[model samples]
Target: MSIQKIISTKSNLVTELLQNIAIEEDWAKIEQFTIALIDNFKDPRILPGLVEKINTLPFDEANAFLVYACGEYSLEDCKVFFDLWIELVAMGDFHTASNAGFILANLPEPFDFNERQLDQAENKLMLALSKPVTEEKALVIKEVLELLK
Candidate 1:
């Protein structure tokens, strides 16, 4: 179903719809929903639940979209997204890892990282870069490395 139909319905089913779309690997619908969620993040009623649902998704294209959507959140509010991103990076989902890295690179607020945490992130990125990845992923990895520097 179209995101417009889901939004117009305004049913509590938005989360369910998102879950189904993600499970079904419907990238188009997920992108549409991500845009809608990002646009409406200021709405108190929608943000929390949406973020929570996004967090529940396994690392995949949907989670990549979730990371992009979570980019609109404050650093504090984005901790969960960061955690998921790091995990995904370690597990080697190149698209999600690269997108998450981009989000971290551009976060509006500074995220304080301990030396060990910084080292770990650096190691993960370095390792990922060593492996074969698409040019797009490599570009994002380089951008993230620049930010880390």
Candidate 2:
């Protein structure tokens, strides 16, 4: 089957859709589609906002999206995302922070954080890292960190 067809599955459809759009170099569509998806995440009518948020997240916004998807996490969950951000910080790039806010704006409540909230950002990254890092994602995060460092 075509790549697009394969990505049509519900499980990873959103991620795959974004990936295809990214590969096609279609930022405009990505941004627009993402905006709507993000909005849905803010106040989901169907599934939990996190579910859709995680689905639509592309590689570009994985960290932010992952944190957002995890929702109002316990201390343990916060650490996963925090450690990941630190690795990003050590690389001297703050784009992760930007993405974090982008993802945060769509959260339901309580867990929502502002852009300048480094403490919260750190927590999110730690939360992400604490979880089992998939092989594909691990490679990408490592590469980005290396490039930034």
Candidate 3:
């Protein structure tokens, strides 16, 4: 169903779990394929769901869905996941961590950090750097490290 129709029907699909801990299926239903085309598609209803469960959801699905969220989110909303991004960067598996690192870099402008966050980011990036990665991902991680400076 189209997002509007799904929303209009109160389908218990997107909205019910949108601001809470959604199951994987719940996130999968969001109109991710077309979300960007809508532009200005900032559905504030998503605020808590994205924050509360992003790291735990399946990465490929969550990552794709989150790209749209990041595109529309205000810097403050983005901050709620700020520490989660840093933690994701430290994961040992590239499959699990790369997209999180990608999102971390692409999150709203400034992605401003307090002193403790900066310290934590530095530590996590250092751990990430110690693992094997393609040059492309390394560059992405490096860019985030630069932002911390």
Query: TM-score of every model?
Result: 0.59, 0.30, 0.61
Q: Which candidate comes out best when scored by TM-score?
A: 3
lDDT of 1 by residue, 17-87 (tens): 54554464466876776566556434443445555655567766656666656666444565545545555
Alpha-carbon local distance difference test for all models: 0.62, 0.41, 0.58
Task: Give the clash total for candidate 1.
Answer: 0
- Among these predictions, the greatest lDDT belongs to 1
Ranked by TM-score, the better of candidates 1 and 2 is 1
Q: Which 10 successive residues of model 3 have the least lDDT summed? A: 32-41
Q: For model 3, how does the per-residue alpha-carbon lDDT over 34-95 read when each residue is reduced to its tens digit?
A: 24322434455555556555555544434545544543555456666777766655642454
Clashes of 2: 21
Comparison by TM-score, 2 against 3, better one: 3
lDDT of 2 at 10: 42
Colliding pairs, model 3: none
In candidate 1, list every pair of residues with a backbone clash. none
Tens digits of per-residue lDDT, candidate 2, 2-110, equal 8776545543545544444345335465445555444433222212333334334443444353343343332333333443434443222234444433333333445
